[model samples]
Target: MRIKLENGKQNELISLAKRNLTWKELAEKLNVSEYYLRTDLFYEKRLLNSEIFTKLSKIIESDFSKFIKLKLEDNWGQKSGGKKSSGRLKKVLKPEKSEELAELIGIILGD
Candidate 1:
């Protein structure tokens, strides 16, 4: 239940949020207030509790740390480690593509 942030999860969360669920819906599903969700999404607050983080992980069907790291990376635009692989491929993914990818992630997660 200890949800430590990781790179993979953060990406997944962004993908999920962008594609499958709005931050409001996600917040409702997670049983947290919208203010907190915005804080978590916009203000870069790390979700520390295992229960809440676990709920989100379950919804996304991903590990908590990976999701957290993704959130951090998306919000902060900071690299997780060495070099980012996606340079040109990322350009190919337009807004629609991102939405599709997010949907796929949600489907895989069974949401």
Candidate 2:
């Protein structure tokens, strides 16, 4: 069965997987190569088979159905409108200032 996920669901899955196990560990548990998991599955957004999904759900301790997105026949081939542009000016941070701010945060958090 072909399963489709929301645009960012792949990234979210990777993040959740990482919290419980390292990429290498996860690959070992899934019985796939780490490179395949990182490149083909995570980065390339490959459609996973049900067996893989079941293993993943077991490892992550969450239902995989939550990430599955269902599309009706009418909208099956349609592409979603991509992320909207914020169109707002934002401040850029300098490296030195960013480091200083990080140091201040560290100091405050240590207190």
Candidate 3:
């Protein structure tokens, strides 16, 4: 499915393989509330804000536009009028750099 974004761009939710991240997981990763995340998904037509989106892009090993496109595709492209689920596995923010930064900070702080 595809939907138009605020940028007037069309995006598709090809499959969970595209993002593999859930809305709740993405909220936690962005340090934002799920409500805020869902609001963005529905109203703002985006999953993460610009800054957070950049971080998320790295985390999920995908481009930021992919997230926006996926959200649009997921929420808006449904003609079935039934609930949609991403199957079993969920995708969350998993940036290698974020983990590295955490480890580096722990080492520096002697934690």
Candidate 4:
């Protein structure tokens, strides 16, 4: 799941985080990169992992959930939907017999 906060709330979260702790400190505590928090999550306001939001919510002592919009990442387009390969293997084994095997078969029949 991903979390996307409202426009105003985006800046609010950043201010709260800055007041409570250093940006680097917050990133370290949350086990994420500052680049991700600032660039994608805050500035670009892109959908980010809900796990990060949950952890940040705790540190900032705020419930940003009300403004949040959840986006579920799915591979619907990429889903195989049981069509993995070209289906069952070909049963044309006769054509694959070695020349020696064919000769042996003819010898056995006295051909």
Score residue 16 of candidate 2 by CA lDDT.
Answer: 79
Better of 1 and 3 by TM-score: 1
Q: What's the best-to-worst order under TM-score? A: 4, 2, 1, 3
lDDT of 1 by residue, 31-110 (tens): 77777666664343554455666666677676545334323323232443324544535445545558878989899999
| Selected candidate, larger lDDT, 1 vs 4 | 4
- In model 4, the runs with Cα more than 4 Å from the true position are 74-111
Candidate 2 Cα misplacement greater than 4 A, ranges: 70-111
Which regions in candidate 1 have their CA more than 4 angstroms from the true location?
Answer: 6-18, 65-111
Clashing pairs in 1: 6-65, 9-66, 9-67, 10-66, 10-67, 10-69, 10-70, 10-71, 11-70
Instruction: Please report the candidate that would top TM-score against the real structure.
Output: 4
* The 10-residue segment with the lowest total lDDT in model 3: 8-17
lDDT tens readout by residue for model 2, 1-111: 445667777666666776868889988888888988888788745666556667777767888687788523333334332233345558997666687788898999994
Question: How many steric overlaps are in each model, in order?
Answer: 9, 0, 2, 0
For the record, the alpha-carbon RMSD of candidate 4 to the native fold, in angstroms, is: 9.7
Overall local distance difference test of candidate 2: 0.70
TM-score of each: 0.42, 0.54, 0.34, 0.57
Local accuracy of candidate 4 as per-residue lDDT tens digits, 26-109:
778778888877676667456656677777688788788888755555443245544564476677755667999899999999
- State model 3's lDDT: 0.51
TM-score of 4: 0.57
Report the lDDT of model 3 for residue 100. 80
